[model samples]
Target: MSYRLPARPRARFSYTRWQQRFAPYLFVSPFFILFLVFALFPLLFSLYLAFHLWSPLDGLGNWKFVGFENFALALGAQDLFWQTLKNTVWIGLLAGVPQHLVALPLAFVIHQSLRRYQSTLSTILFLPYITNAVAIAIVFATLYSERLGLLNYARGAFGLDPVRWLGDPGMVPYSVAAVVFWRYLGWNVVLYLSGLQAISEDVYEAATVDGAGRWQQFWYITLPLLRPMMFYAFTLTIVGNMQLFEEPFMLLNDGGGSGGAGLTTAMHIFNTAFRDLDLGYASAMSWLLFLAIFALSMVNNLLFSRGGER
Candidate 1:
C-alpha cells in the first residue's frame, strides 16, 4: 500500500492581520463621516427646504409643500429678484472687466522687468486680497463718507462739490464696484503673473530671433498660452462677483441704501431668508443664482476652448 500524503493545514483568520488590512480606511473614515454629517446633509436639506414653506420659528417638520411656487415667484415680474440680479450683473461687469484689463499688462510688466523684486512686489500687491473683508469695507465706508471723508475733503480743496458717494442712488453701484475692484485687482495680477511664469523663455527668444517685437510676441504667444489661466480667473471672478454681498452690505446696510441701488442678488437672498423669514423662496433664488453662475462659467469655458483651437 502507498503511503498517504500529509493533509494540508487550514490558515486561520487573525484579528491583527485584518486590522492592518483596513487601517488606512479606518484612518480616513472620520473625514467622510464629518462631510456626511455637515456639508452633504445641509446641502440635501436645503434642496428639500426649497420645495417647502418652512420658517425656523415654525419648528421642524411643519413645512407646507408648495411644489414649484417658490421658484415661480422668484422668476416672476412681481419680485425684486430681477432688479437685484440686474444690479449684480452690472456691478460684476464694472469690477471684473477692469481687473483682467489691468492685471494682464501689469503682470507682463512685472514678469519681464521686475524679476529681482518679484517676491516683495507680489506680497505687497497681495495684501488687499488677504486682508479681512469687514475691515476693508469699514475703512472704505469712511472714505466714501460725504462730508468729513478724505475723498470729499480733496474735492473741497479743489473747489469742487462734495460728491455723494453712497447717498445718491446713481453713485451707489459705482461706489460698491470700486471697492470690489480694489480688493480683487491684486489677486488677478497674481494669477496672471503665475501664468506668465509658466511660459517657456525659449518661445520668446525664438520670437525675438524672428524679429517679432515685444507687442507682437505678447499678442501672439503670451496671450494664446495664457488662455487657460484667463479662463480660470474669469470663472472665479464671475462666481465671486455674482455672489457679491460684503462690500454693498457693509457700506449700504441691509436695506441696500437709498433706492436699493447697491443690493445684489446675494444681499436680496439674505434679506429674504433671514429678514423676512422666507427660507423656501430664498433657497429657490439661491439655486437659480447658482444656475446663472454655472451658465456664465460654461460660456467662458466655451470661448477659451474655441480660442485654444484657433
Candidate 2:
C-alpha cells in the first residue's frame, strides 16, 4: 500500500526521450531505406539470380535453377571471357602503374617547391576527375581519331605518322588506359598532397637541422611517413582500374570497338545481361570479376603489410 502504485511505470519513455533517441535514425532512415531497395535487395537478388537461368521475357519467379552453370560457362574455355579478362588486367596495369608513379612525384614537387601555387594547381588538376566521363570520352574519342585529330596533328608537327589511338587492337587498350590515367591521376595527386600536408613541419625542420639535404629528407623521412598514403592510393587505383568501364565503353562503343580489344569484364557482363538477356550469366560473371578484384586486393594488402613489417 505504501508503494503507492509504483509511480505508474513512467510510460517506459517520455515523448522527448523517444524523440531524442530516434530522431537521428528517423532523419537517416531514408538513405537506409533507399539503399535496401536499390542496392542491398538488388545485390541479394542478383546473387540468387546467379544460380538460376531466367530472361526478362520469362518474367520473375519463372527462373530455372541451374546451380553453377552460369559460372562454369563464364570460366570455361570461352575466348571472349578470357580475352576480356586479359584486356581488363592489361589496361588496369597500363593506367594504374603510371598514375601512382606520376602522381607521387607531381604531388611531392607541388608540396615542396610550389606551395604558393598549390591551390591553383590542385584545382586545375582536379578538373578532369570531376568532368563528366561521357563528355570527356567523346572529346578523347575525337582526339584519338586515326585522322584529323589533335593528337595526329601534334604528331604531324613532330614529323611522325598518325598513330591509330583507338583503331588497332594493340593500341585500343593503351588509348582507353590513357584516358583512364588522365582522369584518375589528379585524384591520386590530391590524395598524396593531403597526406603530405598532414605531415608535421616540425619533423622536416628537425631533419633540416640534422643536416639532411632535400633529397635525403625526402628519401628517409618523407617516403617512410608516406607509406600509409601510398598503400591507400595504390589500393584505390587497383580497385578502380580493375572495374573500369565507362571511358572504354563510351570511347569504344558497345561492342568494345575493333577486335574487342577495349572490352572490359564490365562491358562483357553488361552485354550478357542486357543484350543477351542472360541475367543469370551476367550475375555470375559479375561475381567472378568481383572475386578477381578481391584476390588482387588481398595481394596488395599482403604486399603492403609485409613492407610495413619489414
Candidate 3:
C-alpha cells in the first residue's frame, strides 16, 4: 500500500497565475509612477509653456496666449541664435567626427599590439572624460590664454607668434573643438574596445586563414560587424555635441567668450531663459532646438542603417 501526501493549502495571497503574471510589474511600479509624476508632467507643462507668454512673477493663470511669436523671435529676431546654432554644429562635427576616427585606430592598436598594457592605457585615456568639465575647461582656458599661456609659450619656443586662441572668432571653434576632442576621445576608444571584445576571435582566425591582411580584415569583417556599436556611438556624439554648453560656458566666463563664437545653441537657450528672463520664448526655442536634434538624429540613422540583414 502506497502512502499519499497531504494537499498543500494555499494562503490568502497565494502565488497564483495572476500574481505571477503581475508580480514583476508590482515590483517595478514605483519607477513608472514617479516617472509619470515628475518627467511626464514637466514635459507636458513645458509644451504648454512654449505657446504662452508669462513669467514666474506672473501667476500661472495669467499666462497670455501667443501664437508662434516665440518661435519667430528665436528663429528670426535673434542673430545670436543663428550664430550659436552654426557654432554648435561646427564645433560638434569637428570634435565628434575625429573622436571616432582616433578612437577606432587607437582601440585596434591596443587590442592587437599592446594587450598587456590595455587596462592601464585605457584608464589613462579615459581620465579626461570622467573629469569635471568646469575644472578641465578652466585649466584648458589657462593653457589657451594669449600671453604667458602654455600653448602660446610652446608656440614661442618654436618661433611662432602668440595666436589669439580665445579672442579671434576663427580660432575659437578650433580651440573649443580641440578641448572637446581631447575630453571625449577616450570615451569613444572605450566604446570601440568593448565592441571589439564582443566580436568573436574565431572570425579573426578565419580571416587570417584566408590570407586576409590586417587592414583588409578590419575593413571587411570588423567594421561591418561593429556597425551597431558605431551607430550607438554616433548617436551619443551627435546628441552630446549638439548640447555643448558647460565647457564653453566655464571657459568663456558664461557667455561663450568674445564674439560668441564658441556659444552653442544650448548656451543661447540658457541665456534666453535666465538672462533675458523670457521663460515662454525660451520654452519655444527649446522645442525648436529639440526638433532640430531629432532631424539630425534621423539623418544620422538613415546614413548608418544598412538595408539588408547581416
Candidate 4:
C-alpha cells in the first residue's frame, strides 16, 4: 500500500499574487538604488558637462552651452591630442603584448611543473600587482637615474656605459613601458592561472596516452580552450594600458620629463583641464578617448571571436 503526504496550508498574511510577483524586485531594490545614485547620475552629469563650458573655480550657474566647438578643438587642430595618443598607443602596445606572452607560460609552468610551490609562486607574482603604482613609479624613477642608480651600477660592472633611461626623449617611452609591464605582469599571470585551473587534468592524461608531447598538448588543447580567458586578459590590458597615466606621471613628473615623450593622453587631458583651466576642451578630449577605447575594444572582440572560430 502506498502512503500519501498531507498538503501544507498557505499563510493568511500573504498576498494572493502581486506580492509574489514583485518578490525579485524587493530582493534587488538596494542594487537599483545604488546604481541610480552612483553610476547613472555621474554618467549623465558628465555628459551634460561635456557639452558645456564651465570651470571648477566658476559656479554651476556659469555653465554656458557650447555646441560642438569643444569637439572641433579636440579633433580638428590640436596637435598634442594626436601626439599624446601616439605616445599612449606606443607605450601600451610595447608593454601590453609581453604581459600575456610571459604570463601564459609562467602560469602553465607553475600549474603543472611546480605544483608543490604553486601558492607561494602565485603570491610572489601577485605582490607587484598589489603594490601602489605611485610608490612603484617612485622606486623606478630612482632606478632610472643615470649616475647613482642600481641599473647604471650594474652596467658599469660589466664595462658597459650607463644608458640614460629617463633623461633622453628617445629612451623615455621604453622606461615608462617597462614600469607598466612590471606592474601588471603578475595580474595577467593570475588571470591565466584561473584559466588553467578550469582546464581538466584528465584531458592532459588522455593526450599523453595518445603520444602527445607537452608542446603539442599546449598548442592543440590548452590554447584553443583558453581563448575566452585570453581575450578577456588582452582586452583588460589594452584598456588599462591605453589609459596609463600614474606610472608615467610619477616617474617623469607632470611635464613628461625631457621632451614630453612619456606624456600620455590621460596626463595631457589632466593638464588641459587643470593646468590650462580648459574644462570644456578637456571634457571633449575625454569623450574622444573614450570613443577610441570603445572602438579598439570592439575590434579586439571581433578578432578574438573570429580566431576562436578557426
TM-score versus the correct structure, for each prediction: 0.93, 0.93, 0.89, 0.88
Number of the top candidate by lDDT? 1
Per-residue CA lDDT of model 1 for 113-139, tens digit only, reads 898888888888899999998899889
lDDT of 2: 0.90
TM-score, cand. 4 vs. native:
0.88
For candidate 2, the 10 contiguous residues with the lowest summed lDDT are 1-10
RMSD of 2: 2.7
- Over 4 Å off in model 3, which ranges? 1-27, 308-310
Give the clashing pairs for model 4. none
How big is the RMSD of model 3? 5.8
- Supply candidate 4's per-residue lDDT for 86: 91
Give the 10-residue window scoring lowest on summed lDDT in candidate 3: 301-310
Write model 3 residue lDDT over 1-310, tens digit each, in one string.
Answer: 9999998987666578768899889989999999999999988887888888988777678898898887888789545677888999999999998999989988988987898999999999999999998789879989998997999999999999999999998898899999999999999999999999899999999999999998998899889888899989999999999999877887776578778889998988898778877789888878988998999989888888668321
The local distance difference test score of each candidate is: 0.92, 0.90, 0.88, 0.88
Candidate 4 ranges beyond 4 A from true positions: 1-34, 307-310
Question: What's the distance in Å from true for residue 290, model 2?
Answer: 0.8
Model 1, global lDDT: 0.92
Of candidates 3 and 2, the better by lDDT: 2
Residue-level error in angstroms, candidate 2, position 7: 12
